[model samples]
Target: MEELFKGVADPVRREILSLLRLQPLNVNQINEHFGDISRQAVSKHLQLLEESGWIKIYQAGRERYGYLNKTAFYSLKEWLDAYLQWGEQSLENDHGVFLEPTAYEKGAPLTHPVMLQAMLSKDKEFDGLFYNAVRTTGIFCKPSCSANPKPDNVTFYLTRDEALKNGYRACKRCKP
Candidate 1:
């Protein structure tokens, strides 16, 4: 558990994980995602991730492909589930309304204003972090969605189901 925490502690490592969440990539491909970091640094991060069981590496002829080992995240998820339950209990007791925890509330960083700016700017790096749901249009879209809506009229959601539950449909453009 401590190893897992250490593995994901760095922002670079987290970004690597985020990239892997989308699809498996070779070390060179992963290194290309970061302009500031050297290939050696990325390789070291990959080694840590592999050691911590957060990722698995396999060779495909000349290239070594790294894929996210999602099962390794289960332990972290279990730990967070306890806190989520506590939060839900606290909310239920205080507000008299049960509100299920959203994915963003669990661990996503999309709640930050900077992340909102990233979404508005169509930053592809944050594509899987959250979805923008336009209240007026009743539609949800990916961060890179081509459809632009007023920021005031948009609410971000952690999942498509959350947006759908709130009466927002998936946008045709981004297909959230």
Candidate 2:
């Protein structure tokens, strides 16, 4: 745990982790993102991250690519979950209603195809997982909403806030 903390302590290392989250990249590719830092410095940071299990390096021919090792952060995630549980309890106490947990809370992958199928089938199982926003009508609905729009005209959002942020209003029927 100390090693993990040390690995993420530097801003440069944190930036590297952020980059890796998007996709794996070789040292040269990673260095391109930072104009001021030398390749050697980035390499050193990579070595520390690898040693701490924050990243895993793969060699393709002469190039070494670093990929984010999400499993390595299980301990860190568990630690954060404790605080999230506390926050949920506090919210419940203040609101007099327990907060409903989303699939994201259980580490379910949010995929478009899965969500689209659920919406098309009116699957109530995915009601809280995501919202279906219609591009043509500019309205978002719960997955089980009776209204069905053409798949091509619909886009799925992880949250109602995300749909609203993209200029979609809640469906009058679903009240999403």
Candidate 3:
């Protein structure tokens, strides 16, 4: 979210995250490390980090402890990883040969070769079976769509939801 991005954009907040990553520290302990700022400033940074879901703040006796919350960071990593994977083509091997997904990634529904062929030929019969996501255009289309995406620029998804979830929108031409 925009708020989440803005939350970590501050240098002080990012430093707080780095500390939390090591171990949970109480407000006083965290405040001691920053020589340039007042305890109130450190607490403000911690509060913003907690509100953004990057860290958790909990009361233990008289002190409030802050710890890294893996969920937000994990989700962030996965979301960014989706774009990284999409951009990679991730298709090359050291041998200078292009590789298709010979082994379907853990839960993927279709083989790359099969889906790639269907997309290249614009096969109508395979429309619902898979969607071709174009990395360059950030669009996903039904295999039946006339879009002729290059092999290296596309990734296949099993459903519209899968494509949308990965940040690709449906092609207006395909209305997928």
Reference-based TM-score of each model: 0.50, 0.49, 0.49
lDDT of 2: 0.84
**Candidate 3 structure quality by residue, lDDT tens digits, 24-84:** 9999889899989998888888888888888998898998999998888877888776444
> Whose lDDT is greatest here?
2
Show where candidate 3 strays beyond 4 Å.
86-176
User: In candidate 1, residue 70 scores what lDDT?
Assistant: 78
Clashing pairs in 2: none
Judge candidate 3 against the unseen true structure and give its global Cα lDDT, from 0 to 1: 0.80
Clashing residue pairs found in predicted model 1: none
lDDT of 2 by residue, 1-176 (tens): 78889999999999999999999999899999988989889899999999999999999999999999987788788876754664445542332222335533445787776677678768676787899999999999998899979999998898889999999999999887
**146 Cα displacement, candidate 3 (Å):** 34
Q: For candidate 1, what is the TM-score?
A: 0.50
Better of 1 and 2 by lDDT: 2
